[model samples]
Target: MNIPNTYGHLPLAAEAAGAGHPVLTWAAVGVIVTAVGVCLVVLHRRRDTRSKRLTPGYDAATGALVVLDRLSAMTAIAGVTTELGELAGFISLLRVAEARSPEIPFGVIVATLDDYAASVFTANYATRLAADPSLLDSYLALARVQGVKLESARTAITTVQRRIEKLTGK
Candidate 1:
């Protein structure tokens, strides 16, 4: 049986003519451009989401805790260092809760424990992280702490919501 070479010789003709080379180059460029555009759009959206999640109120509370950590590490601070240290520790726990929780409303309630506290915590936390060159360890620690807090907060919120539903009878 003899098979007809309809498009089989196209490659040979392309090679001989060299006319298809420019077309191939343009196609490649088009593909690359499209890929890059998609990547940029994805990256931009991720950045926007992160920024929104890490709001100023949230940052402040976390920052104060970080500062307290640093101050505790250093000696010759003002009076009531231990008390301040404890307060900072508490704030840190709260920040951890905020970071891990997906429920935004609860996080916002925790965040608004006075704007000053939130700002201080966030600034200190950011500064401490910035100063430390090794971030992986800190990030992992924060993630773990946040996860526990998140679960606890979620459970508490669910319980409260259930109670409200029971009372309202809806």
Candidate 2:
């Protein structure tokens, strides 16, 4: 049996041997439209993902300050203010440094406090103090006696407070 080649092997052909490429049909148009719609949807989802994944800097700073505030309030020793004053001075230095270099980690302050509290009593106690503000007058005195330069720590609180308030207003 012999099979007849009804149509030429070339898919695109001119009926009169002079017609150009075939005109795209509605099915092709539908496919193109569907592809464009899918691309749009992917772009939208990527934007949403970026927004949702962004970390909250303002909230984190507020939380850290609250812990420090609580620890300050709970501590009760003669010149407790002075001992913590040195630590506060360190914070002030950090704040100023941060102003100069925003890449500074907030954890630096937290870690310093944790170490100072450990020298006085225990890390657990310091953490509790962080949660509630306990004792450390001697540490403050030693810091002052050794010239830790706590002037900035003493006044940096107000600066930090103002900065936070301004951020809040925005």
> RMSD to native for every prediction?
18.2, 14.8
- Give lDDT: candidate 2, residue 170: 35
- Please write out the lDDT profile of model 2 over residues 2-63, one tens digit for every residue: 99888857554565566554455566888999999999899878655433322233343444
lDDT of 2: 0.47
lDDT of 2 at 93: 48
How would you encode candidate 1's per-residue C-alpha lDDT over 139-162 as one tens digit per residue? Answer: 566545544444443344444334
lDDT of each model, Cα atoms only? Answer: 0.49, 0.47
Could you tell me the lDDT of residue 76 within candidate 1?
A: 18
Q: Best TM-score goes to which candidate?
A: 1
Cα TM-score per model: 0.32, 0.27
Our model 1 lands, by Cα RMSD against the true structure, at 18.2
Q: Over the full model, what C-alpha lDDT does candidate 1 score relative to the true structure? A: 0.49
User: Where in model 1 is the C-alpha error above 4 Å?
Assistant: 1-21, 55-58, 66-170
